[model samples]
Target: MSLRDAWDRFTASQAELEADDEQLEARRRGTQPVGRCHARSRATVSGVIRAVTFAPAAAGPALVAELYDGSGSLDLVWLGRLEIPGIEPGRRLVAEGMITSADFGRTHATMFNPEYRLLAPDSAEATP
Candidate 1:
């Protein structure tokens, strides 16, 4: 690699680095980009889980995970679920569900109770 390329790589922000990695992995897995998914359509997205949040509601508890696929991020909400095995931050997985906009005017994408499969750690990476 050129010196300039090396310097750019070294100086890239954590989010940028992660986005690049997630995008590459998504392509390798042949999954659709989260950014390209539209509302009311079914999509399968592959990405690394960035964050997990739990919120208690009157009906039941909700577990929400933020998945980033480099192009964009999607919030996966599992209503009435306290927790699920292998659903955590930094883990890679593929999730499929109907796309919906969390806000009016279609800003952010969210999927409720998506079917998901946790991917094994990459051969070059250590198990989280």
Candidate 2:
């Protein structure tokens, strides 16, 4: 890498670097950034699964995953499911569903039982 590129990388914060990488991946996959998605609108977003949590609710078991796509994170919730095959941290995928902000205009946005496709592990074949 060039000296200027190295300098920029060294000066950038960890979050900035991660955001840049996520944005690049989103662009390459032609998926919408999670931060740009509006409430109550249907959107297709691509990102890496950061965390997965299994919480038992009154209705049923819920699997919630935090998907970060550089710009922001979206919570993917699957009701009545304890686990899903290939749903884990560090996996990349594209999900589509109606966006909802349960916190009333707060930073939290969620998609319930979104239609998703798991991507390959490498950069190659990452596009759908």
Candidate 3:
């Protein structure tokens, strides 16, 4: 890569990291820490989607997504939804709903059918 190309990549990565950090800070400022969430309690949390999976559920299909802030992570579950247009790994989003204590295998904490908002995209997240 040329010097300019290398510089561009470096700057892009830094921007992504900063944006991720900003999201984490914003989540901490207004919401309860995900790790401290209690069973059946209504919680508001925000973070970046680190992973996503569509699993077979008794009803049909379920979307299992992992949101990770700097402090912690939580699992967001949506039953009967095959896919959401904007939900994917690397997306920053906020979710609000009840935290279920119901056992979900390896899930840390789960929110079913929570209200969510997708944040603005950072180009760094889209870069290969």
RMSD of each: 3.6, 2.9, 8.0
Estimate the lDDT of model 3: 0.77
TM-score of 2: 0.87
Error of 2 at 44 (Å): 0.5
lDDT of each: 0.86, 0.90, 0.77
The CA lDDT at 69 in model 2 is 93
Worst 10 residues of 3 by lDDT: 119-128
| Model 2 regions lying over 4 Å from their true place | 1-7, 103-107, 124-128
Query: Candidate 3 lDDT, tens digit per residue, 1-128?
Result: 89996776577776566655755565555866677789889988877798999999666899889887765678898889888888899887778999987586644778889998777785222222
For residue 73, model 2's alpha carbon misses the true position, in angstroms, by 0.1
Clashing pairs for predicted structure model 1, backbone only: none
Candidate 1, lDDT over the whole model:
0.86
- TM-score top scorer: 2
Q: What lDDT score goes with residue 44 in model 2? A: 95
* Candidate with more favorable, higher TM-score: 1 or 3: 1
